[model samples]
Target: MKERIMSKDLMNKIDALGAQEYMSDAQLAVFEEHLRGEHERLIVRQQEITNTSMKNPESISGDEADKANAIQSSADARAESEKNKAMLRSVSVALQAIKTRDYGYCIKCGEEIGLKRMISQPAACRDIECETLEERKNKQNPAANLKIS
Candidate 1:
């Protein structure tokens, strides 16, 4: 996903608000809007992928190469759908956090996620430090990060 660019006006507002008042109403609105947009986009893309895959039925009477290609295509679509679903869940959680007035704090450390980080990645639930540490841990032990679902 591309990082959202903060407008100069929003940046100025954030600068004026300071750390103690992080995720001011304006900031939350911005992040909420971005997250909602991403959620809608992912839903549309997932639907498109599903529709396309459905339209391309696997051919049972084709050559072995054609069968293989169809299977690979189906697998690719499934993977992409799964990825979109995961993103949708993240976006939904972020939206819920916004509604609960708990949007900007890091889930792991309880620190402000910072205006710049929230603007750039609206669905983020962790501050950079905690997120970095989690990523490192996941890299070292990938199985620990796997979701059974």
Candidate 2:
């Protein structure tokens, strides 16, 4: 995945909004544009992964090592696709929140998620404290966050 590098001017603008206020119209516009760009980029990347996976066939008449490598590569591609899908979902949710005027607030605690955090991770749905607690809980009981078919 390509790393997102926030420009210094953008960071300064976000920082100037202060930590107390909810995202203003300008802030929301910035985030909305960013999320939209990410959504498109992820869609394109997913298509590329799907196309590549379709073009690459598993070795049917190769040495055991070659077969294993092919299997591993396929698995890796699948994992990456799944990750991209999850990110797309997150971006979608963030966009929806922006439309609802609930962006930059923690879903779990109903507190401002802070401009710094939002600027760094626009898809964040929780504040740092709540997020840390949730992460700890997930770590303590990983299976609780998983679904089985």
Off by over 4 Å in 2: 1-4, 7-21, 55-59
Residue-pair clashes, model 2: 0
lDDT per residue (tens digit) for residues 27-144 in model 2? 8987898789889999999999998777454544679888777778788899999999999999999999999999999999999998778877879999999999999999999999
Q: Please list the C-alpha lDDT of all candidates, in the order they appear.
A: 0.80, 0.84
Q: Give the 10-residue window scoring lowest on summed lDDT in candidate 1.
A: 1-10
RMSD of each: 3.5, 2.7
In candidate 1, which residue ranges exceed 4 Å CA deviation? 1-21, 55-61
Error of 2 at 28 (Å): 0.2
TM-score of 2: 0.86
Q: Which candidate leads in lDDT?
A: 2
Residue pairs in collision within model 2 = none
